[model samples]
Target: MEPCSSPPLLSLGTATTSLSPHPKPIPTPTNTRLAAYYWFLVPGDVFNDYASLADEINEWWWFYDGVLINTSPMGGTLIARGYINGNIPHTGFPLVNLYAHFTY
Candidate 1:
């Protein structure tokens, strides 16, 4: 991914929809320690096989900070949950300035 001048902004206004019912929150794992492996939800219909998906991910390897794997749960599903390192993007500065400096 290209270097961003600012952190991405999350807009909640359009996130929730009145047309459809809200989705139940996914249960958070109890042990949230840092890990090397990351998970991603790949749609079943999108790829013909796992190799194809792996190839696509490999093609755009630069965009990801770490590697992606199917783990135990992936298995060609419409919605697969994955995990990633907490340190993606190398966590630098906050998007917004917490305090402003005034010139005298």
Candidate 2:
């Protein structure tokens, strides 16, 4: 992932840090935590499967080189398809920012 600090996404009309994904509330945490804060969501666990994560998302953003190039309910499906087909342009580091929205 890139640094937590990033250029403003004024289009959203909100102030946020990349620390939280999309600045939306989640219905439940992978585990119960006070307010289900950002850090409470589970990180890399060998048990997490692709289908579960994919189905859990309400929306997401696809960033290339730290810039959001596509989004959910828009280009989200295409982005996921591209990734599955080995078409996403990931350079150097394979991990991109997680900018997803889960139901709240």
> What are the per-model numbers of colliding residue pairs?
4, 1
Error of 1 at 19 (Å): 71
lDDT tens digits, residue span 6-61, model 1: 85597467656565587778999998654332333233312222223344344334
User: What is each predicted model's overall lDDT from 0 to 1?
Assistant: 0.35, 0.32
Candidate 2, 3-103: lDDT as tens digits: 77877766665557555556887577576432211111124322222332323232232223333432344423223321221222322332322333333
Candidate 2 runs further than 4 Å off? 1-30, 33-63, 69-71, 75-77, 81-104
TM-score, candidate 1, is 0.17
Cα misplacement distance, residue 99 of candidate 2 (Å): 10
- Listed in order, each prediction's TM-score against the native is 0.17, 0.16
Report the C-alpha displacement of residue 58, candidate 1, in angstroms: 1.7
Worst 10 residues of 2 by lDDT: 33-42
In model 1, how many backbone clashes occur? 4
